[model samples]
Target: MVIPILMEGKSKYLSSLLVIILLAASSLAVHAQEKPRIFVSTDIGGTDPDDFQSMIHLLMYADRFKIEGLVSTSFQTGRKQNILDMIDLYEKDLPKLKKHSKGFPDPASLRNICKQGAIAWAPYKGFRKSTEGSEWLISCAKKSVTQPLWVLVWGGIEDVAQALHDAPEIKKNIRVYWVGGPNKKWGVNAYDYIAENHPDLWMIECNASYRGWFMESESPKDITAEAYYPNYIKGRGEMGKDFIHYYKGHIKMGDTPSLAYLMHGDPEDPQGQSWGGSFTPITRSSKTIFNRNSTVADTVATYGVIEWRFNGPKINVPSDSTVFTLSIGGQHWPGYYISEGTYAVRYSPKQIEVGEYVTISSITELNGQKGTYVSKAPWPGKPEPNDFKLEQHWYGDKPDQELFLGQQQGAKTVSKHRKAFLMDWAKRWEWLE
Candidate 1:
């Protein structure tokens, strides 16, 4: 009788243990499913070396989200090999990372998803021939998942723009976070295409908000850009060693705010406070420069998209495929051949209160033709909708909003969360050690 009683007690204990184990496993599966799906389009090896720093930071935090793709955008200098090289370093450090976090993705999986994007910026219509990178982005967005794919564009938005051009339906399945300031200036044509065509798509055009990553006010000395590296990241691990190679090791991860947006807070609400800066819906406006030359009296709003149209000698080049060059403020900008002899180029002025002269020397009839225009403060009035006008989209804080540290337009929204995010990153850096 005593032996039977003991056996029954042991059976009950085993059943309770099994139920606890099963419950724990179920909890973990749910957590994994809740991770945001991410696709990154970066110009890692392009003119800016800061991309390398952002890539390293991304790899270290890979386990936090479902990393769907890594597409390199700059064909002139950046390549998929640049991303693969970082994966190699991650592979070397995988063992140590795995010791701390089981969710670290396999290096092989990451390499497989790394693809080369557009070899050049988009033509006049916003998309050229689709590349392997754009196709991969489409495939990821078309997946049957319930969550929207979060596209973090670290460099040119050409691929995302092209992917949308090819598969407009995918817009419903993806959300875009673009680090557009100088990047916007470079890829203005592609940016304009999406703004005009896909106004309803959910996107955060973070022009100056991303600047908050490195630029902060009243932050602790240890967490400042110069001090944080030596204090938390220097001599820590393989990632730490590789990080110093970019931007002289000072933290200029302008692209990192995209990741921070997903890391903490509700990504669904761009207006809500998060480690990434808050944003407001953008009011749309534009200016058109017609066939004639402009005098200094003609003015455009700073950051407002401007369309330059020139009626010149007709060439036999393919429609929407031909490229022309416009020299404005000593910078060469690409112009596209529209129907017939008309050529168009879209530009956004970055400087205010400065005179910009536009000249196109590529076309014979358009040669020696010069126009002068001055950029004033950004337009404050509500947009008057027109066929050529930009549609509504989300952007950094408005020009008139109160800011922290008197930072740039939307910078304070991001700078306000600096301490919380930096400290969180510090904890992750310790894992490398």
Candidate 2:
């Protein structure tokens, strides 16, 4: 009788333990489902090596977000293989990372989603043709998931622009965080295309806010960009060791702030406090229209959209498609055909205080037209708040504003939060051990 009584108690205790295990697993599954869906378009391994550093940091935090796609849009020389190589390094450190994080995705899965984007910059129309990277982005954005697809543009905006040109409906499902200062200069045409066409699309254009990631921080020396790598990152794991290879072991991950913005606080409110810094709404963009070719005496606002209209020989073709190439400042741009003999092209000036020569050439009558134009600073004045019924696009505050750190516009907003984010990142680095 005593043995039977003991057996009955043991059985009940085992049943309770099983129930606890099942409940714990269910909680983990729910947490995984709740993670935000993210897609990354980077120009890694192209002009600067800093992208490599950003990629490494992103892999370490893979467990925190649902990484949907990784695309390389290196207009200079970056390729998809660059991302693949970094993933191989992450695989080596996966065991340790998994021990600390619950949802570290399989390395194979990440490789499967890696894709090559545009190898060259977009033409005048802001997009040339779709590449594998753009196609993958479109597919990921089309997913029926409940969460909005977060597009983190770390490099050129060519792929993002192309995807939007192909499928404008996806605009409703994506949120963009673009590190767009120097990158904007490189992909001005693509930037202009999106800003003009998708004015209502949700975006956080971190022109200067991303500068805060590596700016002066009040954190301890051991965690600062200069000392943190040697103290907490170097020799910790394969990912840590690979990180030192770029920027001589110093952190200049200007692009990481996009990820940081999503890391803490409510991302829905751009003006609110977060690790990624805050931004104000961009109510308007400068646009100038001309019916004839421009001359050197004509000046346009820097980064402002420029549109030229021309009447050429009538031809039947797809409207809004690349029908002619506009050469300006020695670069070829795409021009589109409207109904009748009208041809149009849109361009954004990337340089200030310099005159750029322009020329138009095509097989049609719209050939051999020549002109020049000078790009000046942005038009002076405060832009009114966005009144668009759709989503608002955010940009850094003006330079004279108190939000700026140094000469870079809209930098201080990000620099102020440097310490908090660096400290949090330090804790994640410890997981590599």
Candidate 3:
């Protein structure tokens, strides 16, 4: 069977083409394994300091993150005048952002780049309703060529829930980065928001059953809700100084008769001492549908499966109601182990149902309290038992823009926490690396 085949110019060219095709396929494989695309959906004008700070960070990584679009949700609900006023304040103060932080973009410049001719800067076509917003987001996700979209929803996940229900096609295209819910203390509004409409879609409750909170205790002075501020903020420029002078009347801290929140770094939780990063994970299933419901009036989708009512370990809190610690789980041997389905969560002391999987949608914690975690738990959007109350609320001084701004200026103090937050931020920018 040894016949000498004569190789022509065409044969040589075909071999070269095959090599190029293989190289292209290998390059695509590498690209497919890259980081997720990030789209930030913030509840703009909600007066939440965390969302505002998060926005600054989002903008800082604008180039690295795909940032398909921005949507503003849950602004002050009643009164058109109040809404407009709040929007104006939000818009005006944007220019002042850079004055507070070197990492943040100049508000005016950011506006120019992102804002349309409207008071609000949502860029999706059509009326900027929540349903429409979610639809557009879904479209953005489906259309992304680089990676699966990670929706960094730093507000109510209602719109996204709606979008998922409306566009089943979008289910496979995105993963939600939810930042809401007070664990068991709060109902699954985000989950219910979609579940009612899309019965088949999975619900990754960020509340109940999910061991979604972590705790850390720092010095009394430094341990305020504004703990992460010092890691990111820098000096405000000229415009920021002007805004501070002019808009002094609008800033108010708590119910104080005259005083605003004191803007200073706490003496106890000094800039560089104890550093930590904390967040809770919600639960959803990979097998869930993409779109559950879509209409001219509303286009939403519900996608993903979440194991139901699965409970996990509970953290122990002190009678003082301030300090917290983890009920240490027996460390497992390196190799052999049974899964949760194969075993049960030892929740006998707390009366938590062992085998029930719970959904976690969001987590919140206060500044002063100590937080502890039962190290082994599924990440955001997985279910666990509703046993111990997650560490919630930051019991500290008045929350003010200035306090956050001050923290931003001194963000370097909590470098470890800052790095962790930035690592999540880095995930949004995986396409770059």
Candidate 4:
């Protein structure tokens, strides 16, 4: 009886030990399932207000995504000093609306908008950092181990291009989503640069000046290519209204006119009724430019022109063909708007967490629909359209939403930590779909 009793006690202890081990393992698995990490690289005030809008969106969605770092690049725009100061001020005071609004920025609520700028943007002056953009990107990529690193580029590819040229590891691991050219024919340097050095890296191109504006009409319902004016936008309430006010207030100078600013739909413009988001499907393809031999005589092996074809169709494209656009006022803007189009890739948060891998399924379709076929995968299932929420997301009730908007809009009546705390609170949404 004594021996039997001793055996039973020993068995119970072993079972408890097993339970502890299993629980520890389960905890580890859950911890490992955290969200995919993201990095944003932008040229603040570079092109249009689109990058500005993206910045706002990033601030909003800061919860669902882990923004390991933010690198604001400078190219084709202003030097780093002016750009940084402008961005610093902008971040300090992004105008927004109030009055019973949902997730929007309001001017009257949260007052000060000071946060640390990207490390490279320091010296608080307008000088460019000696550290190359690619080096920074490559360093960030190598440093991140907990999750995959995504590099979102909102300007010229010079920095990323430089980085890929310098670091092989960056070319292998980092995924790049850039908003720029392959305009119809000009500024093909990035494409040429990639072909020569970093061909393996994945890229998502958001074509430049892709969308335009629309004019106001009695029938606001007209089928239009431009941005839907005050009415449709107002539906988003104070936030949307404030945005339009800002756009109208600022866009009346330089190269164009009031009529050109007529609310036209442009992919690059942020003021359209049809707001652009991540899941809007895109197409990706190799960007290649073929030129004719410039020499008076074509040498047999040296200067002969090589004809190029896309798919199987014979394009009337010239080897020496050049693109030129003439404005209505007879202004000649010389160059081509060569675009390689944009590509869409889908990957799920869960799969990324479990497998530590994400895959690019395919480019978007020609009809502006998502692709029917995904080329490569260990995809958990088939590809489906993704409606992305703000990155680090915290879904709140109407009251919470109102509060959040109030904080964003600078109401002067709320907490200073509203934005920062809101960002912190967003981490709770990692498991949310």
Highest lDDT against the true fold, candidate: 1
Clashes of 3: 73
Candidate 4 deviant stretches above 4 angstroms = 1-35, 79-131, 180-187, 205-246, 249-433
Off by over 4 Å in 1: 1-33, 283-291, 321-323, 351-355, 377-396, 404-407
Ranking by lDDT: 1, 2, 4, 3
TM-score of candidate 1 to 2 decimals: 0.87
In lDDT terms, how accurate is model 4? Answer: 0.33
* lDDT accuracy of residue 303 in candidate 4: 9
* Global lDDT scores for all candidate models: 0.80, 0.79, 0.32, 0.33
What is candidate 2's lDDT per residue for 209-247, written digit by digit as tens? 677677674556776778878876877888888888898
Q: Candidate 4: deviation at residue 136, Å? A: 1.8
Better of 2 and 4 by lDDT: 2
Candidate 1 weakest ten by summed lDDT: 379-388
Q: Pick by TM-score: which candidate is best?
A: 1
Models 1 onward score TM values of: 0.87, 0.76, 0.41, 0.42
**How well is each residue in 103-125 modelled by candidate 1, as lDDT tens digits?**
99999999999999987878778
